[model samples]
Target: MLVRRFKKSLLVLSIAASATVAHAESFNRIASFGVIHNLPEGTEQSQETSPEIIAASEDGNTLVYSDSPFEALGFVDISDAKNPVAGGIVKLDGEPTSVAIGGKTVFTAVNTSKSYTQPSGYLMALGLQERDELVRCDLGGQPDSVAVSKDGRYVAVAIENERDEDLNDGEMPQLPAGWVTIVPVENGQLQCDKMTKVDMTGLAEIGATDPEPEFVDFNSRNEIVVTLQENNYLAIIDAASGKLVNHFSAGSVELQGIDTKKDKMLDFTDSQTRLREPDSVKWLDDNRFVIANEGDMNGGARGFTIFHKDGRMLFESGASFEHQVILAGHYPEKRSGKKGSEPEGVAIGQFDGETYIFILSERASVIGVYRDTGDAPEFVQLLPSGMAPESAVVIPQRNLLVSANEKDLIEDKGPRAHVMLYSLTDAPAAYPQIISTRTSEGTPIGWGALSGLTADPAKPGMLYAVNDSFYANQPTIFTIDANQTPAKITAATLVLRDGKTAKKLDLEGIAADGQGGFWLASEGKTSKEIPHAIHHVNSTGEIDRTIDFPKALLANEKKYGAEGITLIGDTLWIAIQRPWKDDPADQVKLLAYNLKTNSWGAVRYPLESAATGWVGLSEIVSHGDQVYIIERDNQLGESAVVKRLYSVSQDQLKPAAIGSDLPLVKKVLVHDFMPDLKSLNGYVQDKIEGFTVDAAGNGFAITDNDGVDDSSGETLFFSIGKM
Candidate 1:
């Protein structure tokens, strides 16, 4: 089985590589619509809002999404595909869980459950143009997913009377068993009185008495397929007659080459056999469907599976999709123990003449696109998405794909919930500007949180990067071949001390020591026992010597220590991330340590004043006659104002004693990184942390994805051309 899985992964890589080189028609993000923008006038923007499940009008000109936190249905005008405008929101009586559009009416499943023991909800039909409630059918349970029939004759809602997690540890059999509700629609009007409740009790091996129907979808045959998430089951019902046609266990999968430990390391040598507690179900055709094994209860297969609807598993993705995610540097290492990547949403779209399946990884914040070949799906490309994409809608006529991201980080002051737009065009995929190649054992080189970078002196397009404290247990230097289109991480060398993996080191900066070795800077957090120091390592990744901060500097050292280091002649310069205790408000130190003299001195560098957050240096590199530095603010998205590259002349290397008044060096604005960060249409990432100029004088930079912890898991690595 392991050999088969390995072969499948290799095939996927080959297909992905071919797709990239052949310039195959791909989907690229065009714009992002923040759900907060849909709030009405005078409404506070800081309030939490989310776009969970989305639906589009028949004309494909407008979008409507369910916002449960705000208890409203949000809309957007996407007629201008490249530029989306807020269409305001309509207040709803209950929390909208899912939405679907049929003809001129919008059908929404609203959960009004008073409690899990007495679950209740309603299916609301509203006028798409007038935004008026047309009809409301009491579903008698908390609704989760809603789907409209192809002929616009029926609407199906999955009544998921979910269990309270606090009770019995969220085990099944929490009574008031859920069922499927089918309502007839005629002439854009819902016949609520004719709504039929399809009983779903005694259908699964697990939770047979309490069937928690999670998601619903309809095929061309008017057959409703619903996933019983906690029950680990699936059932098919005739929408017209509301009769059960078939039911079966969602089954289990034995996963290989997967990371099963959340030890702050990306080790993919573990294996597990888990039940596929599928979350979202989408019909590929009348005879087949796909399920995202999100694994709510005791099981999550960590991938997706395709079924023939006749109780036969056609294709199980296993860990192939997660492997691709690992290669793209978007793997969520923290989620390894639960569900790696966590495929949560599945979307099927028929664009032009080809059928494409989009598998959304909620934890990784990426979508895997695959071409359905009727037998086995062919791997295509991965699409970068907003945080925690819960659902997606495809508009074939407009060649557009939309994802409703459900995570709103307003409380953390991060990017808000977003509705991301992608278009199918005759071009190559633009995302994943950096990816990793496989090891000799055919395992992906898992990497993230690229905090610092440096170029090889004699090798053009060859660079090295270090992962920060996010993976504190496994500090590594990744060799990058920037000559590739999406620069490839060719190898990963673990930084070791006494033949053991180094610990408690927050490697934030790296520079080649000119003798096939490297000089590394470890940013210290006094509270965490990691010291502010520098280390010299050979090509074999073994630390030969370590240097601690001088007494004068250590006395005033802050958590924000050395962020970047660059070697120039006999001296090593380190860029301090933030101001120390004795420094001026708007100035940070650029410390210099001479290898031959064995001493330390510093010069202050002026910072660009930020309107909101504090600004600091992230990276520093020496090229030609100048030293390039990356200065950025801690703010994300629209609040960010300073993510720039500045250069200081090499002749300005005047350093004084640490306690003495330091001379401030003059800086020249080399480039504004806002445009490059915005090129992929994602919200501007705040951590433009790594920068380097190769031997060819080409400039390259990267952002730290924070190890996909509360982040979108997008590590943007792009070149700014020649320096």
Candidate 2:
């Protein structure tokens, strides 16, 4: 009896011990896939093998990892977390530059191997279910990356040659040269067909250089795409024949140390070339795509890049980015902080009568307010969100506040991801903690944390994002809806996918259009430096169009990024974050395409030098007879938010042309103070994002703390008496 009693006690203790250990293990938050892409420095095209992550799947089902630092393949089964199990390891002959996955299919892009003697690898396809080798197609020279067709019928592989040690940086590669291999997935048919070499060297010869090739993707018919790179440019290509259609240049970067590794967050630079790190690309409909870039501006500033599928230089603006994160201590020369301040994630949404843009600032734990009337959106600051607000958005009818907590964008502090939901009670503007992705049942899936977010009424649902990786990589996208209660997720999608074409998205930015489409922007910062693009997936998950911006405009604009893409009435407006020398005055264009005119015009916002008391353009809106613009401090951080109003006469854009300086409406004031900031983000936190006019003819705008750190953030509303 004594022995039995002792055994029972011991057994109980053992069970309790085991339970304690299990509880001690931290629950993996949302996986953050590095949002930015980093490549080897200089002209030497070497991709990191292990130290980086490409993309991650939703549901935390799978992960597509690369060891460009070691040039190998790593697969992890994220299904049973608490601790993700390493699925298996595959040794590649060369560097696996990019990877994508869908369902059970995995596609990987292998570049020049470190072994040197081994034949340059092309692309490998593997089936995750059977652990079977689907196919390993070889290629000549070195391939940049691969893209699969929507139906999984074709794979578009962008290939290039190794830099000749003896040749100068400007000289072209003569060996295998540059080409996109369109191979049939079933039998690898491209091997037998006469090899087709499309001359993408046009952008190169003209100075787009070291091109980062990209595709907006194709469905059943011929898919059109845009390619970008330094000295090269944004080019429209015929997917079938590898034929050059049309394109525009982003600019040039001379022979220098252009490191693709140190890049942390999105900034002012080209996506394809060197200005920005080109990590991912998404098609925003069929005509345009948003490219997320991560890199140090090679003499240019850093940010995201936008391009037309037909290779037109869309427009780049500093006002577009959700936010930028530079390492706390590491910065290029004197360009560390935003005018000396740090910024975080940018949240935007629509609510109430007036358009309100709320900004969440780190440290200070406050929210920035940008109020928009008929004129431009004004700026102000308020206390909302939590201690550290990562990202925020506003629900249409229900005036509630939602926020993503990303500890800190630059420091890599605290937990990976956290979120706070708040509401505007009859009391005052105070935010309380609501939902969290880190709970045992919650899935933060934020690779780095939370980066950018926007809402589309078309889905009638809500979406939240974690900066999954790139900036830190492992990022994830979590979605919520109006019907959902706090802490509840209606639907969600992983950040990574099995790319059918040559596009492996490192999800960075999000834009939703009223027309039933959600836009996802990616940052690709590897060898090509291709500009970022905006991808629009319909209700059924089919991409319609993508607007590819020229790589030249990307590099020259300082960064080729379309941080924020929106529809102001029928016209499409894009914001390019960084312009050339971080000088907003250098012509960060606000390109407007008038659906009625069937033409496009540039509205230049001299951002860097726009301190003339005039509001520099960003977080733009068109309300009936008046044009609303928000000038969030791009260079000076957020010391002052100058929300200036401009009137665009319906008659001015008609037969005649009313370009940049149309007319200032001093009387028609929108937001008066620097409304887009939380106290912590300092002057840099006020980045106004979402804006719109509702049925009441009242304008609604939402702002967020640029994901600088994670406190709490908020979404405010204002009343725009009438249109």
Clashing pairs in 1: none
Evaluated with TM-score, which candidate comes out highest?
A: 1
lDDT for model 2, please.
0.40
| Candidate 2, RMSD to the unseen true structure | 26.0
- Candidate 1 has its poorest 10 consecutive residues by lDDT at 1-10
Estimate the TM-score for candidate 2: 0.37
TM-scores of the candidates in the order shown:
0.97, 0.37
Distance from true location, Cα of 379 in model 2, Å:
14
Provide the clashing-pair count of each candidate structure.
0, 210
Cα lDDT tens digits for candidate 1, 1-723: 000001122222223422233346989999999888999999898989989899999899999999998999999999898899999999988899999999889999888888879888889899999999888988888888999999999999888888887888877789989889999998978888999999999888898999988899999999999999888898999998999989888888888889999899999999998888999999999989999998978888888888877777878888888888899989999889887788999999999899999999889999989998886788888899998998899999999999999889998888799999999999788988999988888888999999999999999999999999999889999999999888899999999999999887999999998889999999999888898999999999999999999988989878799999999899999999999999999999999999999999999999999899799999999998899999999988888889999999989988998899999999999999999989999888999999999999999999999999889999999889998
